[model samples]
Target: MASSSDPKLPPLMKAQFLEAFNKPYVLRSVPLPTVTDPHDMLIKVDAASYCHTDAVLAAGQMRPNPPSFPHIGCHEFAGTVVALPEISTSPFQVGDRVGVPGRAFHPCGTCFECASSPTAEDADADPPGYSVYCPRSQNNGIDAPGGFREYAAVDSRQVAPIPENLSAVDTAVLMCAGVTVYAALKRCRLKPGQRVGIMGCGGGLGHLGLQFAVQMGLEVWGVDNADAPLRLAGEVASGARVIDARNVDATEVVARLGREDGKQDRGDMGLDAVIILPESQDAFDYGVSLLRNHGKCIVVSFPERGFHVSARDVVFRDISIIGSLVGSNKLLRETLQFAAQNNVRAVIRTFPLSRLNDLVAEYHKGRGGKLVIDMALSDGS
Candidate 1:
């Protein structure tokens, strides 16, 4: 291990590790991570957000390469830098509020994706950049260790500074939900004033997507059949037309969408794009039905098996079905900045680390918002 760390820190810290597939996590006192690489930083992880990916991993459903046994969970983490690297030129400093996005880590500098860093391009080093397409990169919590502990060692190069208005709890969601939907919106390629539909609008990512879509100047329609999620959609984006897909007829939704500006346009002139978040095939098909010709259908959900879309409709309407993963490092920074300036935030319920097993048990039973583990709440909550 790298010796470059705070000598005053403790040797070990509490963490939750997935000891086996299809089993509950085990608590252990693991050695605290150290800042080894010049681009590394040791973080006192304040908050780690639970995600669907964690549920998938727990179910032994990870595709291609499986996660190692006894792996640390939680890819969406935010914290203060307790120990900084020896390198002075890094963007971060000691005590900087930061977050490491789940998908963008361990980027090989020479790759084409890393070279496409949106914010800055450097000659001597690979700038803190995107690794979404980097073949050699390791996804945090999958191929590499993640933040499910009191403290975590992270790749500083892939970390985004948290906005001052946000706490680590809120920033944790930004790492996953915010960056994810933002990247999905980018993939939609919808212009300002065009219409966009968010299929799972009441959940954590969906509500946040509504906020971001409105801020992006797109007219929004949020779809959810459940009571809790529809309530959340109304609470977060009051201006949006929140539709209950179970009750509302598709023609009515399309008609209402067409008449938004009082011009009474054709019902078939539907949304410019649809951002799908749920895993249900019915939801996917309904979302596609709401799209106009040549509309972009951006898929964000990853079910055990994929959902089916009508091939005839897709070909006839010229709809572009695209898959959007989490954003690159540069997109994470941009996403946080947007959230900070626009007051966009996640409505999260905080639980102490000790209650992780309880949360994991109920994770897929159907909830509407974000759940997070707050390290500060270590008081047996």
Candidate 2:
């Protein structure tokens, strides 16, 4: 472990800040955040990944109340610990490579939601108390400053140690996209040989979900409009089925593969679960139709517009619609460990911090895989 005195800490640093909603982020110098809380650790950010949530927040889509102006926006990132609070009891040490997840708020340990087991089967029995997904909690990159800056003062609970083999870029993706899908799968509780379909398998989160399902021994099926991502999925995940959502109906394709009809001669039965990674209402509606009795449809995407589902279909078909947030701290650690052990990697495109505006433009136009900001290389603007 390296001492805090070993690294020279700077008083000022460059960051991308949102001065107002629907406005371009201004890259400027700002005072570095200090560790005020006992559990706070100051991190020197190396890489940060862009998420759809960041784009949504930038567009001023947050309803009722929005995060105050001049907010830094990026929740998924990895860095080296530069300093720790004097009273800190966190396992992390200075100079330790760590990945920071979006959940920056500390759980109110007294609530039932915090005390109960996260893996419990009964959803209603133990609701989330002060977890990051809780309505009252302050969210990183939304309600609070985030990793878009050169340095961040993060809660120790939200930080996970990065494995030796994984690079900062890889750890950044795993912080958000990786753990999200991992927790969603855990919620599905699908057994081995059970069929699972990824609605947007070619997407950043979808591709990772496909890989996880395959690793868990579930018969995986990927639905996407593009050929490139599907081909990549085929190459990486063996015995995975890919369907083109552009021509053929996604629901129909899944049904045909799963043999949803009472025809024993065709193939397997209906899918046990379908993880919806796209924010499209069509995808959500179609995903429900592809499920077997008591099957689940895990929704992981955030569509700006509201989604509609048939209440009659849900009740009659005995289908469950589960909404998954980012993930818990325990799940985040497990996700990193799983990726390290299985050699699962996120496909990423790196951009210098100077090109952040251009990167945001490209994100609006739609891009495959995750887009990362490398803080090391700057244009010296």
Candidate 3:
């Protein structure tokens, strides 16, 4: 029974707990988590960040719900390996920087979803790269305890080693926010020089999506409800065309985007694709409306109710509304690497773990970039 009993590690650690719905998280001292599986490695969390889904989870509204109450608050976490389990043959060792992206934790590689080859030329494949859809899988932060705690027991197979160039905090935000939108944008399948509109293009996911779209060689027009997000998007991707919906009407925006040739005549020549990233159903309808024939409407967030997309428009216009979850393990690695090489980084405002509630309150009100709890810093800077 000689597991990772590092004397340097404390038996108990401080963790965030959402004791009840619609209440602030309470910090409690709990016993350190232990490695259960052979491949599970104990990690000392260096940083973690909250997303829009954290609020929904705290409200007790998210479906298929978290495993239990007093749930840990963040899926986006990055840290250094502190201890390795016995019998683990994985190359990972203590002191290695790594991140667990919280989706597809225990992917049964034998299942139909996981077994299906992405390189296979079978067009009838049952949806390739849906890594989170494995029937026997459980997510790190959502369906189980997340990384708000000081330490976590993670599967080595599921964790991605941090690139030498990326810090733990930047890698943390990229885990959830970056991967979600990266997956959604890829769903569009638009070739280079093609047009794609990203709804909610200024928020955390939107900003990353705009930059990724630019890197992918697509002509991206990003639309936000206000000017602040547009500013953020502009700062991230110089190639992106940032649009403020408040300043310009949606119809006019759609018309302007359609007229890529600058002719200004309103017609059916709309965007080639629209990647919807906002957590509003109205965005779904609006995204569908902005698409041309056979254009894709990639849905990313979960609104309160279902989308009110027009059936007639979907049928006649051949609008394909695709629902995307987080990206596959391979895609997540690619995003982290692409971000490192391309200088694509999240605009983060850091605070210590003590100020998580403060950030959450401000985040609920909405903001640009990602909010992070820097465990390495004592003050809530």
Worst 10 residues of 1 by lDDT: 119-128
lDDT of 2 by residue, 1-381 (tens): 222333477668899988987888899997778775777788899999998888788888876547898889888899998888777867888889999988846556555555565454544222344365444556667788888889888878778899999999989988888998888888788899888888888777877888888888898988877777666566666668877777878546655765545555322346789998888987887777667677888888867676787887588777888898877777888899989988888778888887888778877755467888988766752
- Give each model a TM-score: 0.91, 0.90, 0.92
Best-to-worst ranking by lDDT:
1, 3, 2
Candidates 2 and 3, the one with greater lDDT: 3
Off-target runs (Cα >4 Å) in candidate 1 are: 1-5, 86-89, 112-130, 259-268
lDDT per residue, candidate 1, 207-228, as tens digits? 9999999989988999998988
Collision pairs in model 1:
none
Residue 364, model 2: lDDT of 71
Q: TM-score: which is higher, 1 or 3?
A: 3
**Error at 318, model 2, angstroms:** 0.4
Clashing pairs in 2: none
True-structure RMSD, every candidate? 3.4, 3.4, 2.7
Query: Between 1 and 2, whose lDDT is larger?
Result: 1
TM-score of 1: 0.91
Better of 2 and 3 by TM-score: 3
